[model samples]
Target: MRKQRDIIKQLTDRELNVQLIISQFSLVFLSIILSYILFDSFVDWLNYFKLSYYDIVYYGAASGLLIVIIDLVFMYIFPKKYYDDGGINQRIFRDRSVGGIFLLALLVAIAEELLFRGVIQTTFGYLVASIVFALIHFRYLKKPVLFVSILFVSFYIGYIFVLTENLLVTIMAHFIIDFTLGLVIRFQKRGANNE
Candidate 1:
């Protein structure tokens, strides 16, 4: 664990790193299925807990919007620099077409919404679950301020997920936040390397 963290730190930039490609695919499938396996109980818990529909909708929409706004700020502040070969514009738009961006995005949208928002979070409650979410990302990020910022955003997203009991809102929020940020971050790296 220490060694891996060290390697990750030395890296100039972060890209999607899969632990095991086949295993990750398998896990995504299995996790989604597992999430649905408990759907009935989850719904029952939601009602039993007496969560208001309005609360759910309001938090879900608000958090989603908040994350998007933050992401856009980051993008503008740190615009991505990408492949000069395809030209930065093409790298941002056209290059993605050649890859599995759409499919991967869809898969991530489904799996993450189901597993993170739908299942574990529902099972654990927001405050506790958000802590876990923050912890999961902790090792990759160590700066106190940055880590706290990310955690706050993650917790906010978790809060909305619990409030709404609607995966669509969380997934859309996560998708927009991640895609815009990830694209810019990636482009920034490529952009920087170009110079």
Candidate 2:
């Protein structure tokens, strides 16, 4: 696997095809992490938000952790189909180092939830921002079924976050889903090697 710096360099400077995939996934993962962090921190920074026991247990801890476990299982069981692994085990868990990536993921997820679900949807009163959020998802996903599915999921997540008025829940849900997708490819490779 390319060093994170090299991958970033290729996208910003080299514009290499190989680098494009890494760059795309990395950027997405990074964004999610940042969103989550900001979502949690910004509210606290302003003394406007705090995670309640309900939020922590139902949204952050339970939903997020459970989703991660389920997704991880699916990912390992069906790698070729589920995740965009790019045939790299490192992409799944990367032996080199994950300090930077893990940190970024958390931050991005927090910030993003704050913006997309907690702040955007809630502030806009769900209907308006939910439509906008669903529409934006169109660019990333092509299939009609997938697009609609994501739209519905987005709405559900937004609603839950709004109901709870906590970004932590949204971030947890998002992280669990995304992290599982990333793990899919690794599972595939592992099974192949064993066979």
Candidate 3:
């Protein structure tokens, strides 16, 4: 954990953003490749993106807002140290504009949902997808609370996917959580700076 902290502290903001871009795009590419290998046809893969369930969008958005509220409550209740992730997340969003934050969050939500929920869960099962999702967030592994939180979040998103059977729903849910938190991080740092 100390090593991770030291390494992250050494990275420039550009380096972090570059790495995030590469990794997220890699996930998107992997989703495409995996879908190609797994599905019977392109059409079958396309079918996975069903957006006809308009009413479920509310459920997904509400789920996301609910999670964000719960997380904010947790942050208030817990020591700041418990929520720290080597300052990586702070570095990622603190300097970004609102538009930048929204774009980054959307990209992440889509890329992750495309691979984790759209491809992996659809192919294997919810449990497998959820486990894999948690594992990929390796930085959080050393932090017990963050690790457990990711597990809970992953499973919750997986449940949303299961209930809605729509990739867009999970993507929207993921985006809302990330975008809202990114804004919080952005303004929180600004407020700290002012203080």
Candidate 4:
């Protein structure tokens, strides 16, 4: 653990960002390949993307708005217990432009949803998928509140996908949550620096 922490500490912001991007894309690619091998059909694993534009728009908007609201409520209730670790703050908000943050969040959302909801949830059901989702977020392990919150969010995302049979909804929700939180943290840090 000490060695791992030291390694993480040594990573520069740009290196960290690059690592994150690579990891997300790797997850996406690996999930697709594994899903095809196990299910023998990409369409079987990725059926959630088959929807009309109107349905996609409606479900995506609704899911995103709902998740944002829930996240805000949780943050309000336990401000200090949220993603208060300086590591996440630095990785997400510090030395990053707004567009870069949004793009990073978008990629992360797509990759995570594809692996967790698109393939895992479709195969293993919601409970197992949610658990796997929360487990992969190792940072949350040290923060109990954040861990529980993430578990709930994962479950909710799975539920939304199951209900609507549209991966776009969960992807949109995940993107909105990450993007909004990144912007909020970035501006808050900037404001603090200004003061």
Candidate 5:
């Protein structure tokens, strides 16, 4: 564990960003491959992209906002240490411009939802998919609070996907949550600097 933390501590922001990009795109590729193998046709995976504006607003965007609110409440209530994951998340967003952050968030949301919800959940059902989703967030494993938080969030997002049956809704929700939190990390740094 000590050696692992040491390795993580040595990673530069650029390296971390590159890793994030690679991981997300890899997931996207894996999703495509799995979908093709598991389903009848290559285009079948695209069915998950079906969009209903009403569901997007109600289930995706609204739930995203609610999760953000809940996160904020927890941030206020808990010690910052409980949320810490060796500062990897803050490093990923802190130095990025708003546009960069938005792009990163969008990429992550689409790629992850493509795999976790659109493919995995659709294949194996919600429980297995949600567990896999939460487990994939390996950085949070060392922090009990953050791990539990992610578990609950994964289940919540999976539930919404089940309800809407649209990947766009989950993608929107994921995008909003990640984008908002990225902004918070970025601005929080700026605010501290201005102090």
Candidate 6:
């Protein structure tokens, strides 16, 4: 573990960005292939992407705004607590462009939602899927508050999937939260650097 952390710590910002993009795309491709092989219908597994435009707009906006608000409240209440470690800031947000951040967040949101909500939740049900999602985000385990936040977000995403039966809704919501957060972090890092 120490060696792995050392290697990660040594990576330059561009190298880390490349690594993140490749890994996220790999996850997306592998999840689709595995879902197809296991379920015999990747489209079905994806909830057929059946949402209407209105559904997409509504849920996307609503969920996105809700999550941003929640995040803001959390940050306000525990300003130093959340980002005190600075590991993510140094690795992911350092010197990242807005476009780069958006692309990274979009890829991550799509890949994670497809695997966790579209495939796992549909297969294993909400409770198990939520737990699995939380567990995979093991970095947050040391921070119980963040861990619980992830669990809640996972369950919320799962619930949206259940309600809409459309992977697009969850995907959009995930993208919004990720993209918004990414932008916030990137700008904050920029501001800090300027200071």
| TM-score, cand. 2 vs. native | 0.56
Candidate 3, TM-score vs. the true structure? 0.94
Model 2, residue 125: C-alpha shift (Å):
1.7
lDDT of 1 by residue, 1-195 (tens): 554445544433224324223434774676556656766653553342334555434554456567767646654565333112223223333334323444544555555555566667876677776776667655435445446656877787786675566666666666655565445545665687889
Model 4 agreement with the true structure over 78-149: per-residue lDDT tens digits: 867465554665555666789988998899999999889888888889999999999988778888888887
Which parts of model 1 have CA positions greater than 4 angstroms off?
5-27, 30-33, 36-65, 71-106
Better of 1 and 2 by TM-score: 1
Candidate 6 least-lDDT 10 residues: 82-91
Q: Note the Cα lDDT for every prediction shown.
A: 0.55, 0.54, 0.89, 0.80, 0.90, 0.77
Q: Which residues of candidate 5, in runs, are more than 4 Å off?
A: 1-5
Q: How large an RMSD does model 6 have? A: 2.0
Question: Candidate 6 residues 123-143, lDDT tens each?
Answer: 788898889988987778877
Superposition error at 94 for model 1 (Å): 14
Estimate, for each residue in 94-141, the C-alpha lDDT of model 2 and write its tens digit. Answer: 321244335434654665565566555644567876777677654325
* Per-residue lDDT of candidate 3, residues 1-195 (tens digit): 466667777888888788889989999999999999998886787776766556346867888999999999989998999999988789889999999999999999999999999899999999999999999889899888888888999999999888877888899889999999999999999999999
- Could you tell which candidate, 2 or 6, scores higher by lDDT? 6
Which regions of candidate 2 deviate over 4 angstroms?
1-48, 65-101
Clashing pairs in 1: 56-163, 56-164, 80-187, 80-188, 81-187, 81-188, 81-190, 81-191
TM-score of 1: 0.60
lDDT of 5 at 156: 96
TM-score of 5: 0.94
**Candidate 1 — what's its lDDT?**
0.55
